[model samples]
Target: MRAITLSEYGGPDDLEPAEFPEPKVAPGEVLVRVRAAGVNPVDWKIAEGLLDALLEVRFPLVPGWDVAGVVEQVGLDVEEFSVGDEVMGYIRKDTVQLGAYAERVAASVRLLARRPAALSWEQAAGLPLAGLTAYQSLERVGVAAGETVLVHAAAGGVGSLGVQLAVARGARVIGTASERNHGFLRELGAEPVAYGDGLAERVRELAPEGVDAALDFVGGGVVDLSQELLRRRDRVASIADPEAVAKGGHYVWVRPDSVDLTVLADLADAGRLDVPVDRVLPLADAAEAWRYSRTGRARGKVVLTVD
Candidate 1:
C-alpha cells in the first residue's frame, strides 16, 4: 500500500512517499480502505518529535489519525460493523506507527463510527479529532443551554466546531477571530469579536454580565483572556495549554470514544453540524499538507484524498 512514511522526526521534508505492507487486522479491529484523511497540526507536531515523551514511536511511522473510508474487512468479535460499511474514526492507538495517511488503515472497532450520511469523505475525515476536542471541552466545562460561551480562535479547526456545538446546545456563543473571519463566525451562529489587544473588552461589550463558560482552542494565554470575561473561572477550559489547570480551569485532552464520535455523526446527519474543508490534496502531497498546517491560517480543516 502507498503511504507517507517518516523514518525520523524532523520537518515536512522528512515525510516521503513510500510503499508498505498492509496493516495487520487485529481482533476487535477493522481494515478500512482510505478515501480521505484529515491533516492536523498535531500530525506535524508528532513528525517533529514534539510528542516523544508522551507516545511511543516506531521507525518508518505513518503519521495521521483522522480517516473516513470504507471497511473492506472486519476482524474477529467485531459484531457492530461488517465488511462494506462506511466508517470514520480518530485512530489514535497507544503507539505511533501505521496510520490513516495510507491507502488502508486498520482501526480498532472501539474507535469506529458510521460516517455521517450528509458529509463528504473529506468532511468526515476532518471531523474526528477536532470535533471531539471541541465537544469534550464544552462537556467538561459544563456548558448549558441559556448560558453564554466564549470560544477563542473561534474560526479555527477546533474553535469553529466548538462554536457550532455550543450554539446547538442552545448557548449563545461569542467567538474570537481575526477581522477577516468575523462574518464566517456569524454564519456559524456566533457573535464574532476580533482576537487581539482588547479581546477581553470586546467580549465584555458583547456579554456585559460575563460569559458562563469559555473554551480556548488557541492557547497563547487565551485561558487567561477568557478568565477576564468569565463569571466563573472554573468554567474555562483549554485543549492546547496545560497551564489552564494552574489557573483553576480544565485542561482537556480528547480521547477516542465511539459514542462521542457517533453523536458528532448524528449532528452532521441531522444538519446541525458540519466541517468546512479549507483545502484538499492528494495523499502523495502529505508533505505540503504539513507545511500548510504549520501556517496557522486555515479557517477550517485540511484533508488528504487517497485514490
Candidate 2:
C-alpha cells in the first residue's frame, strides 16, 4: 500500500507517498479497499507538528481522516457488514495513530457506515468527519425548529453541513462566507453573509430581532461578535479556539459518534443534507491538497481519490 507519511513534522515538502505494509484487521474491524479519502485541517495539523503532544504517533504515520471504500474482509466479530459492503467512516478519530491515507485500511465496524446510493464516492468520503462535526456542534448549541441560527464560515467543510442540517431541523439559517459563495450557501438553504469587518452588524441588519443561536467555525475573537448577535450565552458554540470558547462562550470539540453519523447519512439520503466536494485529486498529490486546505477557503471538503 502507498500512503503519505512523514517521519518528522514540518511543511508540505515533508509529505511523500511511500509503500507501507497492509494493515491487519482486528476483531470487530473490517479491512476496506480505499476509494476516496477526505483531507481535513486536522490531517495537516498533525503533519505540521501542532498535535505532537496530544496525539501519540509512531514513526511515518498516515494523514487521512475520512475514507469511503469497499470492505475487503471482515473480522470475526463484525456482523453488521460483509466482505463486499461499501462503507465510509471517520477513521482518524477512531484509531490512535493509524488513518485512512493508503490503498487499504482497517476500520472499526462501529465507526463504519454504509454509503448512500444517491452519493458518489467523493461525496460520501466528505461526509463522516465534517458532517459529524457540524451535527454535534449544532446539537451542542441546542438548535431547535423555528429558531434562527448563524453559522460562521458557512462555505467551509463543517460550516456547509451546519447550514444544511440547521435548515433541515427547521431553523432559519444564516451563514457567513465570502461574496463568491453567497449563492452556494443560498443553494444550501441559507441566507449568506460575507465575513468581514462588522459581520455581526451585517447579520443583525439581516435579522433585527437577533439570532437565536450562533456556531463559530472560524476562531479568533469571533465570540465577541457571536455573543452580540445572540441573546443567550448558552446558545453560542465554537468548534475552534477552545481558549476563547470558555472565556467567550461554550466550547465544542469534534468527537466521533456512530449514531450521529448514521443520522447524518439518513439526512443526506433523504435529500435534506448536502455533501459538496471541492476537488478530488490523486493520493500522491496530498501535498497540494494540504496546501490548499491550509488556506481555509475551500467551498467544501477536499478529497483524495485512491486506487
Candidate 3:
C-alpha cells in the first residue's frame, strides 16, 4: 500500500510517498479501500507536531482521519456491515498512525457509517470531521427551532455545515465571514455578517433581541464576542478555543460516533445538509493540499481523491 508518510514532524514538505504493508484487520474493525480522504487543518497541525502533548504518534505516521471508501473485509464480531459496503467515517484512533491517507485502512465499526447516497465519494469524505465538529458544537449549545444562532467563519468547512445543520433544526443562522463569502452564507440559510472590529455590532443588528446561541469556529478572542452578543453565556461554544470553558461556555472536541455520522448522512440524503468540495487533489499531492489549507481561504472542504 502506498501512503503519505513522515518519519518526523515538521512541514508539509516533510510528507513523502512511501509503501507499507497492508494493516492487519482487528476484531470489530473493517478494512476500507480508500476512495477519497478529507484534508483538514488538524491534519496539517498534527503533521507540524502541535498535538504531540495530547496524541501519541509513532514514526512513519500515515496522517488523515476522514475517509469515504468501500469495505473489502470485515473483522470478527462486526455485524452492522459486511464486504462491499460503501462507508465513511472519522477514523481517529487513540494514537495517530496508519490512517486514511493510504490505499487502505482499518477502522472500527464504532466510527463507521454508510455513506450518504446523495453525496459523491469526495463530498462524503469531506463530511465526517467538519460535519461532526459543527454538529457536536451546535448540539452542546442546544441550538433549537426559532432561535437565532451565530456562527463564526460561517463559510468555512465546519462553520458552513454548522449553519446548514442549525437551519435544518429550524434555527435562524447568522454567520460571520469576509465580504466575498456573505453570499455563500446566505445560500446556506444564514444571514451574513462581515467579521472585523464591529462583528458583535453586526450580529446585534441582525438579531436585535440577541442571538440565542453562538458557535465560534474562529479563535481570535471570538468567544468574548459571542458572549457580548448572545442572550446567555451558557449558550455559547467553541471548537477553536479552550478559554470558552473558562468563560462559562462549552469547549467542543468532535467525537467519533457512528450514530452522529448516520444522522448527518440522513440529513444529506434528505437534502437538509451538503458538503462542498473546494478542491480535490490526488493522494500523492497531500503536501500541496496542506499548503492550500494553510492559506486559510478555502470556502468549503479540501479532499484527496485516492486513485
Candidate 4:
C-alpha cells in the first residue's frame, strides 16, 4: 500500500509518500480500499508533534484519520457490513500506525458507517471528523427549537456544518463569518454577521434576544466574545481552545463518537448535511493540502483522493 509517512514533525516537508505493507484486519475490523481521505487540522498538528506528551506515535507513521471508501473485506464478527459496502469513518487518532492516508485502511467496524448515498467519496470523507464535532457540541449545549445559537467561524468546515445542524434542529442561528461568506451562511439558514471588531454588536443587532447557545470553531478569544453576548455561561462551547473551554462553562471536545457519526450519516443521506469540498489532491500531495488547511483559507474541505 502507498501511504504518507511522517517520521518526524515539522512543516509540509515532513510528509513523504512511501510504500508500506498492507495492514491486516482484526476480528472486529474491516479492510477499506481508500477512495478519498479528509485533511484536517489535527493531521498537521500531529505532524508538528503537539500531542506528543499525551499520545505516543509509532515511528514512520501514516497521518490521516478520516476515510470514505468501499469495504474490500470484512472481519469474522462484522455482522453489519459485507465485502462491497460503501463506508466512511474517523478512525482512532491516538495510534499513528493505522490511518486513511494509505491506499487502504483497516478500520474498526464500530467506527464505520454507511456512506450517505447522496454524497460522493470526497464529500463523505469530509464528514466524520468535522460533522461529529459539530453535532456533539450542539447536543452538549442543549440547543433547542427557537433558541438563537451563535456559531463563530460559520464559513469554516465545522462551523458551516454547525450552522446547518443548528438550523435543522430548529434553532434560530446567528453566524459570524467574513463579508464574502454572509450569503453562503444565509443560505444555510443562519443570519450572517461579519466577524471582526464589534462582532457582539452585530450579533446583538441580528438577534437582540441574546444568544442562547454559542459554538466557537475559531478559538482566539471567541469564547470570551460569546460570553459577552450570551446571557448564560453554560451554553457556550468551543472546539478549538481546550484551555478556554475548561474555563468557559459548557463545552465538548470532538472525540471518537460512533453514535454521533451514525446520525450525521443519516443527515447526509437525507440531504440535510452538505459539504463544500474545495479541492482534491493525490496522496502524494498530502503536504500541500495540509498547508492549505493550516492557512485557514479553505472555502470548505480539502480531500486526498486515492485509487
**Alpha-carbon runs more than 4 Å astray in model 4:** 245-248
Q: Note the clash tally of each candidate.
A: 0, 0, 0, 0
* lDDT (tens digit, per residue) of candidate 1 on 1-307: 9999998988999888999999899999999999999999999888898999898989899999999999999998899899999999999999899989999999999998999999999999999999999999999999999999999999999999999999999999999999999999999999999988978888889899999999989889988878888898899999988989989999999999999999999999999998988989999999888889999999999999999
Per-model TM-score on C-alpha atoms:
0.99, 0.97, 0.99, 0.97
Q: After superposition, how far is residue 81 of candidate 1 from its true place, in Å?
A: 0.8
Residue runs of model 1 more than 4 Å from their true location after superposition: none
Candidate 2: which stretches are off by over 4 Å? 93-96
Model 3 residue 146 CA deviation (Å) reads: 0.3
Can you give the lDDT of residue 236 in candidate 4? 88
Say which prediction, candidate 2 or candidate 3, comes out ahead on TM-score.
3
Which window of ten consecutive residues has the lowest lDDT sum in model 3?
198-207
Query: Residue 219 of model 3: what lDDT?
Result: 94
Per-model RMSD to reference:
0.6, 1.3, 0.6, 1.3
Candidate 2 weakest ten by summed lDDT: 91-100
Error of 4 at 257 (Å): 2.5
Local accuracy of candidate 2 as per-residue lDDT tens digits, 118-197: 78999999999999888888888889999999999999999999999999999999999999999999899999988998
RMSD of 1: 0.6
